[model samples]
Target: MSTPKKPTEAKAKPGEGVSRRGFIRDVGLGTGAVGVALSPTAALCAPPALAGPGPVPVTLTVNGKQHKLELEPRVTLLDALRNYLDYTGAKRVCDRGTCGACTVLLDGKAVYACNILAIEAQGKNIQTVEGLALSPEPDPLIRAFVNNDGLQCGFCTPGFVMAAKAFLAENPNPTLDQIKRAFGGNLCRCGSYNGIRRAILEAAKSAQGGGKNA
Candidate 1:
């Protein structure tokens, strides 16, 4: 019988074998499996990659107090207030700069605290709802909110108070329509808009008439 032909090994085409995408996918799966298989002690012994940029020293002035903090630059003023400083009056809702729940006065203007970085608020007068009632006697604005039944769940109350404080400070005698427009940026999920407006107007009137009916 004739000798069997020598078996030939097939060569992969130049562009064949695992594609770049397939290689990446396989490597990723393999790496994940390897990680999963590793003991906790072994995993701990491995150097970890950085999770984010290093924290930086930042100083913020809030409600007339100077606060020094070490934080990542990405931290927002709302976080700095509620998280670091324990000033929880500004609620962290609608964090995308839409809802005014985190509203505060930056240099006497209403601004969304969530929209501003803590670094950006440095050296500026940052007024939060907490500062609005800092006096020994309750502020007339607070009195107005309570007297007018301006809130229900009260989650949105602090922000509404700050917005009204800023609005009345600018326009101490704002009309009903003006009060509504002034608070347009803020939202009350409790549907207490009319009561909020009334509170603002009453606060405005009290501000103008020296707080007798606030």
Candidate 2:
């Protein structure tokens, strides 16, 4: 009926062509099949599970008393003393060996309890502030601290006392300059450095006058 009828191209019916949802579903199924095929091999090549060290027996001599405890080797001396032994004199502040708030005496030397491991402290002479007042009369250094008002807030007082005790033992008659230099490791948030220094000096004088150090 016309100059020559053009051949008509056929249109695809509904649901006849690849669809977005269908493509996605097919790809997901293929991936899942691959995963299922490889799962056995993957499991066979996997590494074995590892676990951390368990708690072991630890014995500590604190304040001239021996204590037996089961603790992890990684536990810190400060935690063992404060949490396990109930010796909370060493404040848990700046736990990274700074601030000196967790200072204690190990073998008659000042050390940060947070820095030492509980298991490593075995068989060592451990002295905390609580041990300083075992006698009826408080230690002279403690008396001096109270008299000079060397502490405020009192959080850092125990550390300061322990550090000062070690320092005085090393240099019984330390001058003001010596004290200032030695106490550089310890810090006071309340800014009680002046009173602390005076207390150290007074304690030294008292020791010279036949007063016991501890």
Candidate 3:
């Protein structure tokens, strides 16, 4: 009888004969490459560093006083006044220029303090609501506002008073329509438009004579 032939052993294909250890090593190398590419320290993946100028000495003339401050050029006049100089009369409501809550007199013209830079206000006359009451008695505009009840919460009162002072200086005998047109930049959230108008009118009349028609 013929000897039984041994069963032929099966062999894996050439490319499929990888060892388990080799497969694991290849996978680990690929993962390491991916991590290195995505690393924040890598040149291509890094973000650019940003730098700005440091604070510099700034001289601000506010409320008839010269204040020497170390301020960055980007600092707003309102911030310099409220934060640095401690002139808190200009309310910081609506930091954007749209709200007149930060209004101040810049060289006798009404300007939004938040809109101007502290550096820009150098050598210019600056007047805040607090400056108005420097006298023994309150300013006539303040009296007029109180008499006419031109404020509610009073957050916006300082700005309104400053704007009115600037406006009345230019047009002491302004008509109601003119007053409305001039105060277009200012806003009163308390809906005190009527009282404000009347207050302005009263102040104008008081300026001319006692209770004289505008």
Candidate 4:
């Protein structure tokens, strides 16, 4: 009987199983694939000399002052105020639009500064908590807040002040229920709702007497 032949496995050499032409084509295709994958972020770290999105010139009028700022298009009005212009009266709580801590008056209407783009506020009059007390004496709204104890930590006070200021402007005289409804958008973590309502009511009284115009 002939000696049994041992089974041997065949090892593939470099490019042995594939045609040389196919191997070269696949390598080229792979390089192209890698280039495509990296193309999106290739320009991200490019030097400023390279053509890419750059800072944009934006003008924002705040508290009766015109401010020229160079900011990225993605910057929010809140960031421009607090970060750039040093207007920290609008507390930087709840960077999102939800908390109402960044409330401000845009053209006399209450808006969340965090939701508004700085560029979009061009030509519109903006009012912040700092504007509320421009004179030597504190405004009635501010006084009401102090007297009524509407603030605990005071983080949300500026927003409440601006919101109340806007609401009182539209409705100089509002009932307690109306005050509650008007401030529905604002949330006080300190649970000072009763004091806030009282402050608004007292401010309304002052407005009724024509003590100070908001």
lDDT, candidate 3, 151-204, per-residue tens: 998888999999999999988888888888888878999989889989988988
Residues 67-164, candidate 2: write the lDDT tens digits: 88766565688977876777889888887898999999999999999899888999999999999989998999999999999998888999999999
Please, what is the whole-model Cα lDDT of each candidate in the order they appear?
Answer: 0.74, 0.79, 0.77, 0.77
- Which runs of model 3 end up more than 4 angstroms from their true locations? 1-52, 210-214
Which stretches in model 2 have alpha-carbon errors above 4 Å?
1-52, 210-214
Q: Which prediction has more favorable TM-score, 1 or 2?
A: 2
For model 4, the stretches where C-alpha displacement exceeds 4 angstroms are 1-52, 210-214
The sequence of per-residue lDDT tens digits that candidate 4 reaches over residues 1-214 is: 1121221111111122456786777667655655754676765665564421234667788889887766655567887787677788887676678889999999999999989877788899999999978889887899999999999999899999999999989988888888888887788999999999999989898868843323
Against the hidden reference, what TM-scores do the models get? 0.73, 0.74, 0.74, 0.74
Candidate 1 local lDDT, residue 132: 72
What CA RMSD would you report for each candidate? 19.5, 24.1, 25.2, 20.9
- In candidate 3, list every pair of residues with a backbone clash: none
